[model samples]
Target: MFYFSVSMREVAFIKQNKEKWLNFEKTIYNNQFKNPDELSSLYIHLMNDLAYAQTYYPKSKTISYLNQLASAAFQRIYRTKREKTNRFISFWKTEVPLIVYQFRRYVLYSFLIFGLFVTIGAVSAAYDDSFVRLILGDGYVNTTLENIEKGDPVAIYKSGSNWGSFIGITLNNLYVGLLSFIYGVFGGFGTGYILMHNGIMVGAFQYFFHDQGVLWESVRGIWIHGAMEIFAIVIEGAAGLLLGASILFPKTYSRMASFKMGLKNGIKILISTFPFTFAAGFLEGFVTRYSNIMPNWLSVGIILITLSMISFYYLIYPHIVHRKLKTHVSTL
Candidate 1:
């Protein structure tokens, strides 16, 4: 009867905490806790229960169940701690690249659209003498023409102090990027309009300098920052296109759900281009102003390096990261 009473005690202990154990299991599996501190507190409580079970119910199946529960909680706590420490690094290295890879088609579409408009702008400028002025505004055209006559077609960039130029240009570029992303709400037509506006302006601006017999000079100076600046704009355009596509093609998800997903991912892509945008503005303000004095090789090198860096991040790095993840999952 003493042995029977001990067994009954163990059963009573299991019965008492059965619901609590189930709750802990659910929380662990679903990651439903509000914070790590809460999870840790629950883990500590579970450990105490586990110790009690081990001491008094050493021969019971209750011991096995409590041991498994404690083990799972410990693993979860360790994983949570590790992830918290590495979250920032993981966001850039894995999260953004994966999103870019998933939406690569949008990136291609953006490039095609922007490139087509640029071609149209160039062709229009070639045929019509007033087309450049019409697209770039008469004020800008006159100022540029005056600068060209003074043997510095890009002299407008040299107007402001380096720090002032950097801040102003950076803010303007960020505004353009934000507009490119936010305009996707109009089924992407608004984004297309923005892209067309910018693409045409760029083509016409370059053509104007080319028409003045300073094409190479303009190329040397303009491309110093334009490489990264234009590329970032194109990527932001891709994010906008992705946003529009999500609404137009919801597939298995409800339209609202799809929109939410698209907005989240599109914003992530847009955020990724910010560093490149800032670099472009910095180059435009501080470096491009000195393009006239810098050696042709130096200008070309800067352009190449900036283009390569941004290009690799958006275009090439995505594929590499995707492949690495695929291989890791396969091995697992």
Candidate 2:
């Protein structure tokens, strides 16, 4: 009805094309804009509608209506398919790098969080040897201690069917990761505490194992999965900091807008970390427990391999993706 007021020619054009336009818009709505071409079409239509609104009926109700329609169309199209770039190459080059850039700040926040937690844990452990048991349940500490006495300190990790363990552990770990990111809103200090609680647990766990004369065994066995698993935790901490920072500094947008944007980025980064977490969880549930079953050298080798893979994917890969994108941007 609104697109009918410019002239009889314009009105007749709208009447003739109305069904076609409605059909096209309906398709876009149903698809949620998975197809890039549909978005491009909507973009073109939005621009044309705005231009006509400004040209022929700048002060009319039809012009206002066209502007509203154009805005609605633009919002709908972008909301579902908010990708700023087109291909996998573009995503790697542009999107991936942006994640790394934003994530740098997250890294520092993570370190600071770990430091604070370690200090508290150390102070507590110094006051009482049982402090480690308090932080990591007595059941866990006692079982680990028995494993240490038996010369298989990391054996607690290995029990459960690989497939079931993989799915259950991965999904549960992801939920923990998401909760850590979401809890950053409580001034971010809460998220920092969660991270530190983890760091403290590790510090105490290692110290207890070291106190038992099996530090290297613990390192070789534990780190086989710890490298990837620890890195996943740190990455999750970074995500929480991102959400926290959004609340702390709104920048150009309102506080709500900034938080929402941070949450979006944080969630994406969290999802990206899943494959790594899954591998880590699998290793923890399957490999570390069986460290005693394997040769000492073989266990060490697995540790090195897992560490290498984590470093490559999380740190090295992001940089490579960033550099490649910069080259593409230069060429364009």
Best by TM-score: 1
Instruction: Pull out the clashing pairs in model 1.
Output: none
Per-residue C-alpha lDDT of model 2 across residues 199-224, encoded as one tens digit per residue: 88877777776677788878888888
Q: Each candidate's TM vs. the true structure?
A: 0.75, 0.68
Write candidate 1's Cα lDDT for 1-332 as tens digits: 01123477777876777778778877875788877667777777777788898888777656655665554454455445445547667778767887788788889999998998888888899999989988988888899889999999888889889999899999999999999999998788888988999998888788788889999999999899999999999999999998997788765346886798789889999999999999999999899999999999999999999999999999999888767654433332
lDDT of 2 at 329: 31
lDDT of 1: 0.82
lDDT of 2: 0.68
C-alpha lDDT values of all predictions: 0.82, 0.68
